[model samples]
Target: PRIIVRAIRTAGKLAVDKVKELSVKIDNKSPEEQRDLLQKCAVTAMSSKLIHQQKGHFSKMVVDAVLSLDAPLLPLDMIGIKKVSGGALEDSFLVAGVAFKKTFSYAGFEMQPKSYDDCKIALLNIELELKAERDNAEVRVDNVKEYQKVVDAEWQILYEKLATLHASGANVVLSKLPIGDVATQYFADRDMFCAGRVPEEDLRRTQRA
Candidate 1:
């Protein structure tokens, strides 16, 4: 009985494979013929049990979406798919912009800049923390005044960097590395949308957009 079931499954798989092979044999055909073959295949596939009865609606939606692209050559990476749990399949639609999976480092600043309209964005590929060079030597600060000066200077540098970004009209800041608490607070006080530790690719796409 197991052998009979295995043979039946194998035959069914082979039949599906053969149908797929024959359906795509439009390489040598003219452009019109190729298009017709593709349309027929689309119809057949959409009519299958998997797609339910929304074949015509889905087919038209797909064609309209492709036609809506700005250029003839469509790079699919420019498209974003956001799936919501409560909506029907027909409720799914295409959005015109790229969406990154990043959140603001500070929850308090989320209410600010609800939109990016006319907002300038700054992309920083570096950490917002302070770095020191000791030359493999330890310097001892004997006086409290001198120790305070060093601390003040380090903070000044970080403040200046943040100020520069703010001066550039950057309402949004995306960093590829962790943003120190001081920097995050500075941005939050300014009501800026700052997100840190974002992926490199996301930063690049945000910059391009």
Candidate 2:
């Protein structure tokens, strides 16, 4: 649970930072512009990858988590590939697969994911407001809530996909975008959403787009 909390905390911090960041960006733009920008950002966030060190940090954290849980199954030094589980993993290899079984399942869902830590940073975090840039006949700007809902749905899908991969057994090297829920947890405590720490901007951004 300590590892879980840490993962959540890490994700929380990162998401908070992202929200704060994007909010400022939104503030700089008009409502229509801000909404558009958020859409772009969401798409970008989902489709991108993270830097090496950042990915590495999350990777290491995953390794520690697996080791912590499966310690009894393998010796400390024998934890690497070709060692145990045929480098398969003693637990959900943060560096390996999503290993849904590897990590604790929270929020009533399971997703396997490789560390693929970059997913959080690299992706744009965009919403699906323009299912093709709004209907031409509809000149009126879409409501913020509309875009937010779309974005939220997309983010949720993204999070689930990532987590499923991790939980399944990709415990070596992750490549796909992280599941949004796991991504959310990757930033902070699971309680973050419940406690209202999840940035309002992120939530708003998610729902409309």
The digit string of per-residue lDDT tens for model 2 on 1-209 reads: 99999999999999999898875544566766754554454445444464332444435443454434444754443333322444322243344321111322235232333234423222233321113334564433379888788778766776665455445443222112222344445433321111112333333322232
Predictions: Cα RMSD each: 8.2, 25.5
| lDDT, model 2 | 0.41
lDDT of 2 at 20: 83
Candidate 1: worst-modelled 10 consecutive residues by lDDT: 72-81
The lDDT per prediction is 0.71, 0.41
The segments of candidate 2 whose C-alpha lies over 4 angstroms from its true place after superposition are 1-141, 176-209
Give the per-residue lDDT digits (tens) of candidate 1, residues 5-32: 9999999999999999877566799967
Provide the lDDT at 24 for model 2.
55
TM-score of each: 0.57, 0.20
